[model samples]
Target: MSSAGRALAVPAASDIVDAELVNGDETAASGVDVRTARDRHLSAETVAAIEASAAASTRRAYAADREAYLAWCRQEDRTVVPASAETMAEWVRHLTVTPRPRTDRPAGPLTIERAMSAVTTWHLEQGHAKPNMRGARAVLNAYKDRLAEQKDEAARARQATAALPAQIRAMLAGTNRTTLAGRRNAALVLLGFATAARVSELVSLDLADVTGAEHGYDVTLYRKKVRKHTTNAILYGTDPATCPVRALRTYLTALAEAGRHDGPLFVRVDRWDRLAPSLTRHGRTIGDPAGRITAEAAAEVIGRLADAAGLTGDWSGHSLRRGFATAARAAGHDPLEIARTGGWADGSRVLARYMEDVDRVKNSPLVGIGL
Candidate 1:
């Protein structure tokens, strides 16, 4: 039997139910056998899974772009299924000049590229022939070349600022441990510095992912930049003042006092020490209903704390993680050790780049001079 025929030979019951929910009576009304209808639905699902295999954030952006492109096509009276090269090129022009609804700024080169990728993916999913070498892609490449010659990409790009350990310590000191929010932020800053964890990994943490050790805690991160190196070792601070483990314990105690045991390790709260109401119940306070703190919110919290501490310069969610690697390198730890601790893959040049500024001082020949 052919591949398609073999796949259709078996239909799971859940697939049928899902198909029914989606298609209503349309499939049934067509006089097709139930098995055939279910097989077709399952095939569609397989195609969807294939498309969705990309990162969650990428998939979400693609889905949104797909909708936006379709809307634009409808408004322009253009065909979207097999969007001609001309249509694609025209859409690229629109993306370049159009200000995003939220940001009110024209789409950056990266954003435009992602939008184009989404459009092309949609066309591919529809089984349209991809004349990528000759059509919209060619136009995009030429336009990109012109853009490159016109703009200094490096000058326009945002540089990643590495956080210093002292700055993080100052931020932690600025947090008010007396409040639930402060306690959470304290732990968050400490963990970010200690583990050098990406913002997404930090926000995805749950109460169950951490374990108490004699001196510190072991946090098992399920996702990170390196898939296999998810387990990170977090050490307790020598001082009670800035200890991440103690800060985390205090935060958990606050949660327990409020009758929350398991869920997001960090949650949103207002100034009154009241937790953000769970979205599931909508205004009703119910069991462990605190929602996950978003990455943007987490970064905003760090920025506010930094501002309060009177720390100057541009800080970001990546600051603490960068600080960790910077501090570790300055303390005489080797690159391999730093990479392992920061969840960086073996032989990662990115680690070296992060420690560049710090190394300038430590590895300088002036260090041994009699000045």
Candidate 2:
């Protein structure tokens, strides 16, 4: 996870932190001392709570960003902490102008901005003033314009290639249905596309979230947006080969027979074709059943399936979401209905953007005309 084209140069805690974050410089730099900062000693539970404030992903990025900043400051012979607005501006300018030392590729606008955000986060966390970002943002906007003028791929708005119904079937064909991983992946793909779920929602789906419904299964997304416990139906498709309903049952039935009827619907599968059991943070095994698959792993599953199926185009986790909207629109499903099924807000610009790509050709005024 390099935000920039080049790696962030983030080291492990063993590489960065010493015994304490704020030690006996007599709390000289910041008023707060590490040991006496709070009324109670900072318990592991309290530390976990504080870190949980940001998403796991965000916190990771912040860590990398902080390291990147430190590395950059060391290279440039500048002050590290309590970075000034001028330093930020200088960094962005350097990122914009210089080719990556190793790869010789310039960092994209988005990457530069993210790196800046990571640095700003570090400053604020240490009780320092947030670096004014106006200069850095201006640099970024200029960089974006330069990339657009040069027709760089990074300049274009990112969109995943839609995995339409036929393509979805092709991807399913790539999986070895006999294995636990294969069946689980098939269920993951079908449920993803059928419900237009983001990978995050798909992984959060516990067994309890899925209930039997008329003609299909109704699933409630654990992480809701706009609405709480938002439920959607997975209807039976005409083809048993590609039907989401059958895929889910087939997959779950295997799990049930294995005596796994609880916890995460999706879990890690080892190379041995064994379902991975949930584990504690200490690397200790928790019990039977399994842990939720990571969003990254889910994306890899989609990508691997797409490649195996020989379906051409950029396919990732988001392809399921983008594909669902486009496929439903192609079928003449009402826009509001499509939004409802996907848990998108009615009239969402993001959803509209997904459909609009295909619609440019599909919905052209000249499309059905004699042309």
Candidate 3:
């Protein structure tokens, strides 16, 4: 008649098998049926549904955090059941201030706040009287504010180190295009700057995707990041383009000359006619493994290029993308246009960051000045 009695009546063959697998003959001899160990308060279907709503990455993180939280509760002799508002609040507080054992670092407010939210949601869905998460919400807000401050600080620091587009142009000009590697690097840099592409998008390109037209060639950048609004609109190259379309065209032609087609536009070439793993088995060679290039690889490429060009700084692949956005804004391109080109979902925020940097450099008294 009771819920616990009903749960006990339902057969759980899988649970018994799992118990036998873990404990061998210990569970069978004790006469303790593992099938009856089910959480009578909640159905297995409910738990499964909750997990289905989460993304794969989210699920993994939540699982790890949940295990840690439950283990801690067990160690402290606290109830693992999220059956009351008080219990939920206690858990949220514990997560907020507790130092993680392995890292010995205080759990970041956002990380713990997210874990608490997941737990609260799960508990509430299972008909538990969990807290409303208002406290957790406040902590999350504080965490975001901290992040914003850090971002602002980073933007300022980068502003001081930011290179001008013309400076990048100067560096590009130094590359000796006579050799295959030199030509490839030049093309890579030009495409990276011109498209304002993430290093991943830049590297994932194929020769087939790039086409030459009478006016200029179009390098169809798939999986590009652009403003959601302008996603429907096709953005062509800038007028009076800073870099020539001929440059890209010439590079593609060079690839053809090398007898490479139906593969990555950028191949790893150690010597003449020698190819590297830049090209996948599918006949597509990526500039940076189809945008999954490690930070290390990106750093290596930037460092090598910078060293060769005799330029100084800790430039990385991101610098190329960021530099393009910064330069475009300085050149008087509309912020929305920059966002559309860069595949940003929010244009205003990105524009504001760039405008702030510009103002800093110009010492413009009217920075953030209203129209």
Candidate 4:
């Protein structure tokens, strides 16, 4: 026979049997079984292939939403399996009527739409030939129109009670400077207003981030969430005329006079000025001597200061940022300039939200008509 034909040919019964089996012995000539070792670890190439098949952020969001829906299904005594379009449509309807947790809010059109998108993504990721989310999509669209109307009504309500910039300034003027804590609180409020920083970013500041320069002190912001896309910059030219930064410098100098260093700039000081790490989420002590501050701590500082200053009207960490934008625009500063200082790419939307028509009324000549 040809060599190729011999290679293709199946072995006879005598040749197919192992020599060890024929001899009634336990071990082969090589004393190792290849099949046993192959079952243990996967090859490096196979591991890399599995890692490459992992889902992106959007897909993960969809999966989370789908899991929420499935949990709801079990609670409602509905079939957990989503095999047909009818079940999907029913789930969409349930989402619209369902009451959300911890609030008086109902699951409106927007919520239903997000749920539908998530469920559809889940089916596609599982390699299904055809997803049955068409009915869910139709229900979502109907709910979305209703949600838009509700949003418009809520926006109109907000326009009626918009706080004036002068009111915020008057509130800041009331902070006491007698005690160390009072002075620190005053400085924090001023810094937040001047920098227009998010509460989280403001509280994360360290002593190393601020330094004295020839003109004035420079404030260095590091890895701030707002400046995530851009390189961190130093804010120079800070003085008393600048408001908050000046107040912060005064507080820092006071700390320096006491020989305090090698710790966070904003430490948790009690009534006696003794420092402690701020309490963490699980009530454990955060012992990082120069560690970052939590967003919750920043919010508490704002609330406490507002109470001490006798300021009213839904104040939170966001109040400082919003107040800064309003105050800057009122002082005739350009929107783009304010945005750049606040770490926003553009300030057009912020200006539109906070700037009233009364502020721009001088551009028209009709105000001088009675002359």
Candidate 5:
């Protein structure tokens, strides 16, 4: 938006607290007291940092949960904020019984947990007393048990299929390398797989984050789920056609030629084969993100490439991460080595899950036994 247009646009949901403060309001504009927001004496930069602390998707989920809870409270003529333990327990029950919009099924346990967390976050933000959730969790457990009895699909865990190095090569082979989009995808896939970086981390990379190293490029992942730690991992170059470093060099050269020497490492390509327009965190044409691709869009790039390669299974951006672990394990790398590349906590159950069954057939004890 232009200067005047920007000046006139309403504050977003996130900025409501700050807006009220800026207007010299003693109270909040939102119905909730927002005591926590009120109590904060942070600078605009600090507030912006706080707003950016959570991932965009996470913030959106919390907001949606708060809205749903607020709507239910208003509809049932119950208190909104500072909810009682009974109220919370009843709320979970309501979520379990109510059919999710369009879907006939009620909210699953994970959804219920997230919803509860949303309400908790809202209450905490307002400095309200934490509503005891023991009763609520008990109810959620019962719901899970019921689902387990029925063997509901919602009860089963879903995992992304791993796209091993060979599959990744296939994806690159099928991609139209003559185009900007293809080059970008090639770089994204290679770097993500090589480092076992999450889609979020992959998109979080800025041009400055990557630096040339002896064998490959050393990638500094500044933005991550665990804010306290920033990881530096190498993206080794090999096999000229599918080399992550080579692909990145080609992509970065193209990006530089387009006058994009800085900003996000990966960005959108317009249908016209040009760099996409700058986008804000909320996808407005202005603000922080100067054309960085969202996690969802990046995932689609992987899926689309996978489809072009005629590879099947539940491929996604996560496939790269999973593939890294599997591939590393197959190559006889230790868990510590794999963990270092991917930032998985030592002994993380989820990481262990990915490595499970990977060597079952290949390294079976019975393989060399005589029949």
Candidate 6:
């Protein structure tokens, strides 16, 4: 077998039998089972470490993609471990042409792209040659090009309307501050808007990450690129009703009442309105006592609050981040300043693209011209 093909092979019973024979004398002398020792040597520590390279959410996504690919391999009686270029090309074609189960619609270009990435990563990690297929790339490119001809479907699907300043105020008003869940939700929304924080950053926050400041609060955020903590100042808004600092303070008071001193700043709440009890006291609790909320749940929180406020549109975790950028630009804040507040690295095009629509409207040549 070729070296690449050999790397993909799982251990067979014959190989194990040979190993047992080789170590049989040692096993007899030591009064220990050689097979057991060999199994210990072949533990999954390496696999665990490789999987740990990705964040939890990314790992989950990759796992699902890998499972799907394996299932396809099982159905086709193909080797997934050392998946050949032809096999990969066929998989891509299958993804693009096959109607999804229980639906007539084929997989979208982006979905296929992500699935391909997952497959590629799986191969590399499993000690197999990367799936190299110009044919697959060409096919996917053409498919994407065809989709691009359709304006609505081709445009970025996540390009939903941003929640502006008034819309955010309405969302805040919709929540009742008296209840624990309400207080947490209100603080979560206001803080997210004020900081323009990604859902991951928002959920990863710990009590120690925050400190009281003269005007508002200073939050220490962990920058993944730098692998260090950088502090951002969240200033208090003028209005008490909409002030993020005030809302945060109220939530902190509730936290104190619950006898929580450390751990995740934002925890989960059950459907019955029961709060995820604090893990500070090491007491048993219903639901996850780990305190930190998942990024997906964080997105749902924003959507649910937005729905309650009578806003009409698809809202996701990206909404808060996008809303902050758009709202900041509309309020006449300098683009560079807004970018800095949102943690955009200098000279990055992300901030520019985000503010492009806002700039087009504000700097339009037809603004003062009569119809």
lDDT values, one for every candidate: 0.74, 0.80, 0.60, 0.59, 0.80, 0.76
Ranking according to TM-score, highest score first: 5, 2, 6, 1, 4, 3
Clash number for model 5? 0
Residue-by-residue lDDT tens digits, candidate 5, 1-371: 12112222323355554443467554554565555644534455555555665677887887888889999999988898889888889999999899987688788788888999888866656646568998988998998888899999777666898989889989888788778888898999988888888898889899988888776678888436545344565555467877887898889888988899888899989898899876545645663348888788889999998898899998888999999899899888998888876888768788888778476777788898996
Task: Give candidate 1's TM-score.
Answer: 0.68
- CA lDDT of 32 in candidate 2? 47
The RMSD (Cα, Å) of candidate 4 is 14.1
Candidate 2 C-alpha lDDT tens digits along 1-371: 12221112223233344444355565544644355435424555555555554566777866876776788899999888777778888888888887876668877776777788888766655546678888888888988998899899979776788988889889988689999999999999999988899898899889999999997999988534564566888899999988999999999998887778998899888789877756666876664345678888899999999998887888889999999899898888888888888889867999989778678888789876897
Clashing pairs in 6: none
RMSD to the true structure for each prediction, in A, is 9.0, 9.2, 12.1, 14.1, 9.2, 8.8
Error of 2 at 198 (Å): 2.6
**TM-scores of the models, in the order given:** 0.68, 0.74, 0.56, 0.60, 0.74, 0.74
lDDT of 1 by residue, 1-371 (tens): 22222333444343444434454688676756666555454455565555444567886888898889999999999998787778887887787667788988666666777888877756545545542535555656665676678784522435456667678778777678999888888888888777788787888888988888876788877544466546676777787877778888888889889888998888888768877776555766654456788888889988888889898877889888778887888888888888877788777777777778688887899997989
Cα lDDT tens digits for candidate 6, 1-371: 22212223444333334333454576556644445644534235555554454577776777787888899999999998788878888888887778877567777877777888888867665565578867788888877777777663633545645766788788888788888788898888888888878788888899999999997899887654334566778888888888889999999888888777888898876666666644444555543467578788888988988898889987887778788998899889998888667676777566677788698998899898986
Model 1 regions lying over 4 Å from their true place: 1-39, 43-56, 71-87, 98-105, 128-155, 224-229, 238-241, 253-262, 274-292, 312-314, 325-340, 344-371
Q: Please identify model 3 stretches exceeding 4 Å from their true place.
A: 1-133, 136-163, 170-176, 224-246, 271-273, 277-299, 307-314, 346-351, 359-371
Instruction: Give the local distance difference test score of model 3.
Output: 0.60
Please provide, for model 3 over 155-239, each residue's C-alpha lDDT reduced to its tens digit, 9 standing for 90 to 100.
2233323445665666666666767676676677667766666666777677766766665666666542341221122234463
Higher-scoring candidate on TM-score, 1 or 2: 2
- The better candidate by TM-score, 3 or 6, is 6
Candidate 3 vs candidate 4: which has greater lDDT?
3
Task: Specify the poorest-scoring 10-residue window by lDDT in model 1.
Answer: 1-10
Clashes of each: 0, 0, 6, 1, 0, 0
Q: Model 3 compared with the native: what TM-score?
A: 0.56
- Residue 352's lDDT within candidate 6 is 78
lDDT of 6: 0.76
